[model samples]
Target chain A: MTPDDPKDPAGQHETVPGTSPGASPQGGVVPDSRGEFTPVRTDTPVADPGLPAHQWRPTDVDPKLEKRAERQVAGMFVAAQVFVVLFVVSYFVFDIGGDGDAILGLGASTVTLGLCLGIALLLIGVGIIQWARKLMGDHEISEMRHPARSSDEDRTATLEALRVGTEESGIARRPLIRNTLLGSVGLLGVPAVVLLRDLGPTPGEVATEQPYEGAGLANTVWADGMRVVRDVIGTPIRAADLEIGDLVNATAAALYETNEEGELVLEGTERLIANSKAPVIVVRMEPDEIEDVDGRENWTVDGIIAYSKICTHVGCPISLYERTTHHVLCPCHQSTFDLADGANVVFGPAARALPQLALAVDDEGYLVAQSDFDEPVGPSFWERG
Target chain B: MRLLNRTAGRLSRHRRRPVAGLLVLLLGLFATGTFYAAFAPAQAETTASDAAQVEEGRELFLIGCAFCHGTNGEGVLTESGTQYGPALAGVGAAAVDFQVGTGRMPLVQPGQQAPRKPVIYSQDEIDALGAFVASLGPGPAVPEESEYSVEGLSAEEQEEAVVRGGEIFRTNCTACHNFDGAGGAMPRGGYAPSLKGVEPKYIYEALLTGPQSMPTFSNGNLTPEDKADVIAYLQESEEQPTYGGFGLGSMGPVAEGLFAWVVGIGGLVGFAIWIAAHSTRSLKQKGTTE
Candidate 1:
């Protein structure tokens, strides 16, 4: 029936076999004859499937069992509430400090918080489950399935429906779905144990490989006797050649080629990796103008010297040179390096100096490294301390 | 005719009488004036002494500078000083020339740092200026040029030179001039000039003559062409331009950020208020219609 028809409050229409309106069902409520009328049903019948033979819970059939079940459920809830109180006490009692009475090396505060909260939540979960099995209603019922989509009233009606459905489903009497759902959710703790694998890699796996040995956080491919060459060109430099105020961008010679034995020296990704780590800037001042840093008297050849071009703040490639001041500036953050004074950080965000590459002339008069940088190059990393 | 002859005879007699008297009076006045003009032996002796001093100056030069400046006081190419010093040849008898001549020889060092010092020679030695350097090859003498003379500069020339000078200044001097000519720091505690109130000659000398830590811009290194360009830039363009906004020294990003925060963002906020007011009016109108 149309909502406009006042007489048909249920909004259901009834029609004669051949006519469009004015129809009624036998023994149902009939509307007026004015053509804006229809029939409505007040009591809808429920189809029934007969109940199975009674197999009652021990609590339901015997009064002694019922009293015991009530005590058992209450006991679980009381135990859960006690654990919650213990959780609060542990938060204040733990002193995580240098004494190191930590659980599993975690601070006392961390261990206590995790354990107390975990046990508190677990006991409460167990209490609620015990309550349902021992004390909640138990019965069997049959219901007809309704359409999946619900009316606006169904939103408000869902609680009642769930209650009725629970009675029919016999979740309380069966105990299987109830106990297993509770137990499965509770046992989720076991996988947390399994996930502790991510805490650190196992001792002797990829970490034990020799390719990464000796090289730690603070070292690179730079080393003694390594020839300094033009970065991409790979031609070695003789100190006598650079004019005053000249700046040359160079890299370690090892980045360019391998030894004759056909062994992959500077192999695969190593050359690409070493190229980044070994970048250097060589500047020439007048021989008399060079200021010698203490203990680095021989670091320069005549007046030519090399320094790591990587800025110590964030490892930006730096090449801006003010020849007159002997200050090499990083364009990225303006970190100024004093090339004459051991490439010390004179200004800007850099925490440390651009590390100087000690230079010595080989027998052939080509510039070679006396040794690798005394300290690490590039942005400071954690182990730098 | 008879009367004329008689008058001539009378006039001749009168002439003889008056001429002799007039001649004696004239001679007496002449003697007094000459005696007054030429005084006693003491005055004569002072005059004679001055001439002697000048002669002595001539002699001193013969002994000292004549070997290089010739016997007639001309400069000698083969002289000891010639190997090092330029021919003083025609630097006139000026105070500056005199300062240079007396054992100043080759300067203790070149460049702008040269300072004025005492002459090692006597006054007689300095007085020889006319006979010594002047007697050498004749040429345009050192003029008493003014210390400040950019006045003769044409506006167009000043503008062009200043622009060109700025370029050269950036390439060569900005490292020291600091882009704004504020004079940035230099290596080993040296520094460049402030370019403020610096004299033209000092700049010329600093360039032609390398001073202290500044490298020499000899004709060989920076051609006169380059020096002129630098001078033009330094003299004319140094004053801040009167643009409609703050210059902030033409230091790029720092000034731009200051401008944005002070002007651009401020304008945006002001516009936003105006727009908000307009929007409120429109919203009120729409509400009334609704």
Candidate 2:
């Protein structure tokens, strides 16, 4: 075999001295596979240019300037620490919900916390930039072009190279520095773990009281005789008003309850949680249109029925109703329920029927609940024993 | 089984008349009864308190509504088989009130839909028209007078009403009419109109009649008090202050998030760019001095 092809072992062995395999020999000739020799030209049109001349920074040239630059960088870091302190102080200084703490319509607490935290971050970033530009090593370095693939020899010697590097670093002898570095890095993870507490109390911890005291997962604010009020404006619903083919979004009247002082009985998060589970849709259809589902016959007040709005499929509030078919479709997953037939799942991914609320009208003509839902409302997982 | 037994007993008792003749007689009676029930003129006028109002409404209907709607308020069906306007006979005063009060009636010309506009008649004339339309049939009536405004309630009740109204508005109406009552796009070409400056009575009537493609919120579905709460919320919302600085049109989180990203991030990026430019210029000067 002629000695030109790099892939050919016999050709590599027969290559001319001082010339690379696959490269032309000094006579500008390369051998062919059939033992014939062919002339080749080896020339490059362009030459590689080296990197530009290095310029010295002010800190690199003068000792006084170098010391001043170091002070300025340290000052920025110190200012960052001061801003962090300000952030902590602001957390306690400003009132979150109380009166006279708002600044330009935003909560004073929120504004101060955000501003301090942001400034601290900005200072830290600027300090790091200053340190790198004015004080840290700035010597220019370059590496020669080489194949990305390592040779077998270099691959085998990697462990030995690591050992030599470690020895040169003197980390094994510097016990104080090494342990302190490890301690600081490990301690940084504590704040991240501590912040996880803000995700809210566990389901078990949330109380299950009625009349607006509990978490939504276990119970709602629906009480015996609590009028089913229209959502938004706490107006009581009268049974005489609804016509056939009408659907109304309704909620428990307890949401509008106030104490003697006129403050809400269920305040803040409790109100929000109770309201989430309390949403129900009241729909009216012809009495003949509804199929009698055993005991549910008494649940309707003159052909009007109420059911929880939460879709059993992943808990989206469903209200899209097709009056002719008595089908209420969940827009999120297209889960359809036949409201006339006891709110049964008619189509799509819902695995369970919507929980129906038993209805009764008070002497005042307002629609009221006979009792709480017989079964827990929402996703089937909550109903699991 | 009981029905079958009764039929057999009737057959044995009826020996003089043949079963076929008896069957024909029963069928004729059933057909006549159904036809009468289906086509009978609405008998709601007997329930109306004011006959004079109904009489005035009839006169108004003759002058204005009868051109498209027949003199009997049965609506015209062209020779081409298209209904020029819908029958107003059984739609009642509630429908009449909503259509006329909202100024969607006296349609300039029939097309895909009628839009709300300035009313062509005075309040008295409108009421008369409503009474006339209502007198023709047994349909929903104009509800008794309601104090829909929050001014009627105690201070505490007013606050609670506003809160509840806000909750209701956000939950139900916000899907089509946005959080601030600025309406949004509906499915197809229609839109839920903005609640701004709309009369509370018109809102109540719209809920009952379900003008156009909107689903009806009947008296039983949304009680009178509930309708009042909705009205209260709509009225209160227009006056409510935007406490958290910029409202961004109360278009909800999507629009707010977009604005935050654009202006907030853009400003930050511009500052960073300015800092970088200043730093580089200073570095060049230092390099020249060295």
Question: TM-score of each model's B chain?
Answer: 0.37, 0.65
Q: Which ten residues in a row have the lowest lDDT in candidate 2 chain B?
A: B279-288
lDDT of 1 at B277: 55
Per-residue alpha-carbon lDDT of candidate 1 for residues B1-290, written as tens digits (9 for 90 to 100): 99999999997788689686897799999998888778876698987876665576567656655564456644456335433223354443432243443334324653332334456665455644443444454522322333223346688876766676676666455544566665544443444556655646446545543333444344433445556667767766555442223346545577779888989799768856764553111112112322
Q: Report how far off residue A58 is in candidate 1 (Å).
A: 83
Model 1 clash pairs are A1-A12, A1-A13, B70-B74
What's the number of clashes in each of the models? 3, 12
Error of 2 at A198 (Å): 27
The top-ranked prediction according to TM-score is 2
Candidate 1: deviation at residue B229, Å?
26
Candidate 2 chain A: worst-modelled 10 consecutive residues by lDDT: A6-15
Segments of candidate 2 deviating more than 4 angstroms? A1-47, A50-241, A248-280, A286-308, A320-385, B1-87, B106-116, B139-146, B150-152, B163-185, B213-217, B265-290
Candidate 2 per-residue C-alpha lDDT over B93-126 given as tens digits, one digit per residue, 9 for 90 to 100: 9888878887888888876557789888888888
All candidates' lDDT scores? Answer: 0.61, 0.76
